[model samples]
Target: MQPIVHPVVGYLCYAGYVRASDGEAPQGELTVVAVFAAVLPDLIDQPLWLIGVTPVGRTVAHSLFGGALLVGAVGLLARRRGRTDIGVAFAIGYASHIAADIPWHVLAGDYHELGFLLWPVTGMPAYSGVKSLGTVGAVDITTLWLEAILFVAGAALWWNDGCPGVEVVRRYVG
Candidate 1:
């Protein structure tokens, strides 16, 4: 999926959580932060790869352990600041990124198997023997179409629920 789609999925996950929470709409900041956290694991591990800390950082960032740590840290920080709700919201949002990616991974034939939920520990490349989909030549029209459908669905959900992104887009278009 493209970068934009990732955040939309994050928002969807956040919305589901909020609806389950107080049975009331979540605060705007919580939704925004959840979407932010969804992509944050990637940002943290990218620097390590650049510095030669690992062979490649993709798996590291895409690991469940990494997500757990981020959640723990966020929870701790929020507790310190007396903002526990924000911390938990971020954690769920971040994990939602993983959840969102899981289906795509399987549909793509478990291409990033090792980096799936049990990566870095199992040492098994989920798609080790399979042809890699991450390669430039591997991307094709089919993948694009699938991603486009998912994006459209996300947009519809966001718009129906009056998500922040919908309002932002409305403001700009108007």
Candidate 2:
């Protein structure tokens, strides 16, 4: 998934979950955590891949193990802080990040790339990743179309939820 799609899908997923749970709009704190969690895998793996420890984008941090660790850490912190709701939302976002990655790989015809989903359970394989970050932002056939679809879905959901854009940022994301 594109970088933007990660957070957008995560936010929308969490927002829908919240709305379905009750009649309240998603709170700013949950939005912040969800967005952060959505991108956390990339933030962790990208730097590691640059340093040459991991093979590529879908290694280590993109694994289920990585998602569990993130969720465990956040869940523990939220528990200690007496904020289980925060923990739940964080897990939802983080899990969605891991889940969103699976289909993107499949769609791109990178079935083997999904080995990273298992990580330590399977030995890491070496594959050359894109040499430039520009590749992601560039007008690629696969990602561009996928991104368009995801963005439309995300925007529609946000608009339906009353477009809590700046309010979420001001109250929490900032």
Best by the lDDT measure: 2
Per-candidate TM vs. native? 0.71, 0.80
Model 2 accuracy (lDDT, Cα): 0.77
Estimate, for each residue in 1-174, the C-alpha lDDT of model 1 and write its tens digit: 345667777777777888897786555667778878877766776587689875565556667886777688889999999998889778877887777656655666764464546666756342332232354565544455665777788778767776654454455579
Clashes per prediction?
Answer: 2, 0
Candidate 1, residue 143: Cα displacement in angstroms equals 4.2
Q: List candidate 1 segments past 4 Å from native.
A: 50-52, 124-143, 165-174
Clashing pairs in 1: 113-126, 114-126
Off by over 4 Å in 2: 123-143, 171-174
Worst 10 residues of 1 by lDDT: 124-133
The residue pairs that clash in candidate 2, if any, are none
Candidate 1 lands at a TM-score of 0.71
lDDT for residue 168 in candidate 1, whole number 0-100: 44
Q: Give the Cα-based TM-score of candidate 2 against the true structure.
A: 0.80
